[model samples]
Target: MNGPGPWGPAVDAQGAQDVLVHQALMYGSRHEYLLTAVPYLRAGRRAGDAVVVLVEPPVAAALRGQLGRETAAEIEFLDAAQWSRGPMHALASCHDRARADWWPRGRLRLLAEPVWRGRTPLETREWKRHDALLNVVFAGTPTMIMCAYDTAVLPGHVLDAAARTHPELAGPDGPAAAARYTAPAEFCAECDAGPLPPPPAVAARRSFATGGLPGLRSFLFTEAARLGLPEDRTLPFVLAVNEVATGIIRDGGGRGSLRVWAEAGELICDVADPVRVLADRFLGYEPPGAKGHDAAMWAVRRLCHIVETRSGPQGTQVRMRVRIG
Candidate 1:
């Protein structure tokens, strides 16, 4: 179902009016990237929209060089590397930027590359989830977002998922409706139904009670170090797990299970409890104030490489992973 269009009179696939025009840019080279992006940025500038660009540093540099100092100065730039902090946070930030300063009177135009080379499988998963969640997050806002995926660096599966997540494709030619796009709710459901494989047998497992929180943190640190997770990532990894485990204790019947494993040069942690606390699939993806009781889960999403939640008759489970070495 669609609501009234907020960004003028644009219509979507279901004939529903919407203000958001979420699209993907799959480019195989730097030239192709500029070909599709330059004009898009120029148009936004000409229209006096609040234009923001979040991409890899090199790409940002290239755009700046091409746009020249004045035009480049007009666009706001954010580092895509910090996407590990959470796409929802980035989205909120962009929204806040558009609403602040001189941009409030105009529409929001964003060009973001949330995915990049050297990302772990877990990071890939979470960002893809972010892509699907974007539709729901900005549904009625007067915003246009283009998610760029480097076809030369990203796998075919990644590109395919991009097609599924975005409602349209923006290329050098122009924006067109995406033929394979799945509705936000349906795509999120599909993601929820597919849980990650069980932690490897070699994974260290332990059951923790309220008293074991300290031990749980120690265990995670040891495993993270053993897996050679960089010094910088170690703390966030532990803190993220700590938050989830703390949630399980305070809200999930006062106890939970913890497991840590290393595979594919990444560290994986799983936290589970008998209580089913998250009934809403979009818990972590929603804005902070809107998250209500699921705020801890939202924090976990921001800190970890990937945060996957599943609830069933058995119980609720949260799996978080981060790339080690």
Candidate 2:
């Protein structure tokens, strides 16, 4: 019963060594959700694993109510909003928790409920990429993530994607293999398949050489401010721009082009270098470890509201966005 399956992994057909057990669960109501969560947590407790539930307040209360005082108190109730700040940070937080808080003691049983109600299409796509990355992020760790979706509120596309993102599907009866599950790398690549639109004709654009880098930051700050970035956002926005600009100087050759604009009430900036090629898709996905593009990008993702990076035959380009209001 305790092996590579339902709440575990089947990485390969030969029963590949187990690592992360990633599954999706769809429920239309509180009762439906608890039908799987309650028993899942209880089983984790019985097996001596570290159990954690990340859900909304009302839903958490429902789960708590079902378990009574003692059982509810044993599991950690995490705020989904806080735990899912952004892709890089969320992955780092999950990795850190598994390593620091639970890995050695026992397996981790996480009932994850990410808030997706108000997310823009762009934001939702990025989160889906994060979900795909989860399979590999905890590659060798003993972790079971029950990613939850509310069938009533979420659109069909959102619920449909869960099937592709998770390796298995969790239901009241048990777990079943997710036939539509896409491999992490392929799934992430699919997310980036569409080319980002070019900056509008009215966009403020500039070309910078290695030495003109100082002026690049100045140009960026000035444009961002004039375009509607608040006083508080200008500095971080500049920092994010400089990180990409300098990174190009250090690694992507000595020159690149810059474009700035405002659209749909958000400030957008693009930095491009024809000579740079990215070899690692996860360069900045993890916590900043050492000095390199990885570290530079980690800062870029943190500073900007939403960042999209593309590198290939078209060259490498990084687009950073921050809401104007």
lDDT of each: 0.77, 0.81
RMSD of candidates 1 onward, in order? 4.7, 3.2
Candidate 1: global Cα-lDDT?
A: 0.77
Compose the digit string of candidate 1's lDDT tens values, residues 277-316: 5678787666565336356666777677667888877778
Residue 249, candidate 1: alpha-carbon lDDT = 84
Residue 247, candidate 1: how far off, in angstroms? 2.8
Measured with C-alpha atoms, the lDDT of residue 2 in candidate 1 is 40
Q: Which regions of candidate 1 deviate over 4 angstroms? A: 1-18, 26-36, 61-68, 79-106, 150-154, 210-235, 290-293
Clashing pairs in 2: none
User: Per-residue lDDT for 247 in model 2?
Assistant: 81
What TM-score does structure 1 among the candidates reach?
0.76
